[model samples]
Target: MEKAKEMVVGIKELSSLPAVYHQVRGVLDNADSSIIDLANVVSVDAAITARLLHVVNSVYFGLMSRVDTVSRAVSILGMQQVHDIVLATSVSAMFKGMSPANMNMTRFWSNSVMRALIARTGAEMVRAGELERFFVAGLLSDLGHLVMYEVEPKLAEQAQMLSVQSGRPLHELERELLGCDYAEVGAALVDKWHLPPRLGAAIAGQIEPALADELYRRDAAMLNLARIMTDAMEQKMESEAIAELFDESIWTLSGLKPANVATIRLIAEMNHGEVVTLFFPQLRPAG
Candidate 1:
């Protein structure tokens, strides 16, 4: 784990979050932080501000009135919600212009968006109120693989191939091949970013919620279920095999019913394309 963290640090491309992201975070760290403080820092990035308002006004939120300004968006969503939006937006932007030749960036983002939506549905099924956190956690859960493919493409490729060849989970193969899996790498990177600790924790525990502290277990469980459902949705696993991949403990721990599986997948797939376009329009080629 220590070596994996060090490897992530050595990668220059993902060294830091955007400046505005850090600035907003610094204000968020201050208890006296207000909507104005968030608006001040976020407005500097016109693109983020625009997306923030768009999402605030989108069918996703279903707001009754127009939200034309970052301040109005912040007031409507509250500081914490706005910060999560900023975190999601800035994190998405950080990966822009990174056209890694080997990685299918579009497919990667599609899977992420799908996972995020599925996670949100699962959160709702389980009655977890922190839906945005669940969405962000699922959206970024696979990011560690990006770091691995960036810094050690050959080894990462080997691990991916082995998973397909051996019929074992990728995380298991990653441990054997790289000494750490995407969950650990993603968690370490999230921790380094200084976002919410539980976000990092939930991602870190995607493979096993018990790996996270008690406070974050519910979110972690939600993330784990979402990943499994994404695999099932993408046909990465067979219908019969899908049930096997589910962590039964998540059902017990999260109160999310298996009966909700079809409904969750439907909702995730329904909005996935739109959500992908909203968050990563770069993935779409020239129209």
Candidate 2:
């Protein structure tokens, strides 16, 4: 209890969002917003604009020519995708240079990007709506762990060890050991950050599939499969134990048959490097 309390108290109270990002995300959320609105908002931030242009032209998207401005990027990528890239880049920049002792920042973000990409791919495979926001939700689903690690590194480490030793999921171990789990913590973080309410709820409700809204249910399902698919891609324990998380309905709803699951897993692995770079560029330098 002491250790966990220490961890919780140790985290920074203010996780600042970049001003330009806040402005741009606000514009993106407005239904009547135009591409010119995005271009104007993003153009004000030179660094963000540069990053956006670079990402759109990256080999992952396979554009024939380079993009030089936010307007061109927005025209080609559309609003949702532009929103996703901006969010990812902005969030990455905000959290960059996070202290090494708090967490393996590289691996933590790498896992997040991998899960997010896989989830986005899986969700789109089934025609899930709000695909871009869903991708962001999937990326941030495990954000509670960042707080835990920052607040109480040792206890968070213990909880993680417990998860491994006991073969229970991390969230379950968190509830037992930390009084509250990462999902709740993550939800709290989301609320504090003033993100979309549904995004926070999905993170909060990820462990309780039955209670989640349709979007959250789909969001959780995407994240769940992504985690499993990542484990498979990494060649972790290929046991049926991990497969139980799928249950019956989740698998059927995802519309990925066992064969498709295998194919997706292979694709995720084969494209790991490109996928990681697509989401998190800083990691490549670290690696």
Candidate 3:
């Protein structure tokens, strides 16, 4: 863990979230902050404005009409939701160039968006509060892999190959070879970014939620299922095959059922392209 922390901290790219995100977060944390204050901070960045407007108008939100201005968006979506949207978009931008030689950025973001939607779906299905928080946590769950690949691409590749050959858990191979897995590295990055501690806790314990604190285990369990579901989708695995990969107790933890997995996976698959387009309008389909 120490080595992973050192590696992530030393990397310029992953060390901090974009400054604008921090500024917005400052207002979100301040009791005196108003919707206007948050709007002003967001409006400074044209890209975030466009993305925020696009998202609020997108079918994802299912707003009746277009939301044209940041101020209007603030009034409509409320501070909590807007903060998440801006942070999500800004984080996407922050890691825009973090693709390792071994991984494709298009595929990376696509998987993240899928996992995020799946997590949100899980949150709704389970009646877990704050769907957006689960979405962001799921989106960032795999971030540690970016740091690992950046610090040691060849070793990362080797771990992947070994996992494929051995039929063992990849995180196991990653920890054995790299001194830490993506979950640990991701947790470290989440801490450095000063995100909600739950986000970090969930990421850190995703591979083994049982090891996390009792309170966070529930959210971590949701993320764990979301990750497995997303990976199965990315690999184009069938539902039965995916079923074989699930933790029997995770469904219970998520307040879902075995049958529900099929439904959630189906919905996630159907929505994958549109959600990808929703978050990454600039990206084209990876053919």
Count of clashing pairs, candidate 1: 0
Report lDDT per candidate.
0.82, 0.72, 0.84
Model 3, total clashes: 0
Q: After superposition, which runs of candidate 1 have C-alpha atoms over 4 Å from their true positions?
A: 236-244, 285-287
**Model 2 — which ten-residue stretch has the worst lDDT?**
1-10
TM-score of 1: 0.93
lDDT of 1 by residue, 166-233 (tens): 89889998888889999999988988877788888889888898667988888888888888878776
Q: What RMSD value applies to candidate 3?
A: 1.6
TM-score of each: 0.93, 0.86, 0.94
For residues 74-191, could you state the per-residue lDDT of candidate 2 as single tens digits?
Answer: 9988887887778777777767767548577877887787777777777677787666676687788777788787776677788889888988887777777677777777777766
Candidate 3: 10-residue stretch with minimal lDDT: 251-260
Candidate 1 residue 47 C-alpha distance from true site, Å: 2.4
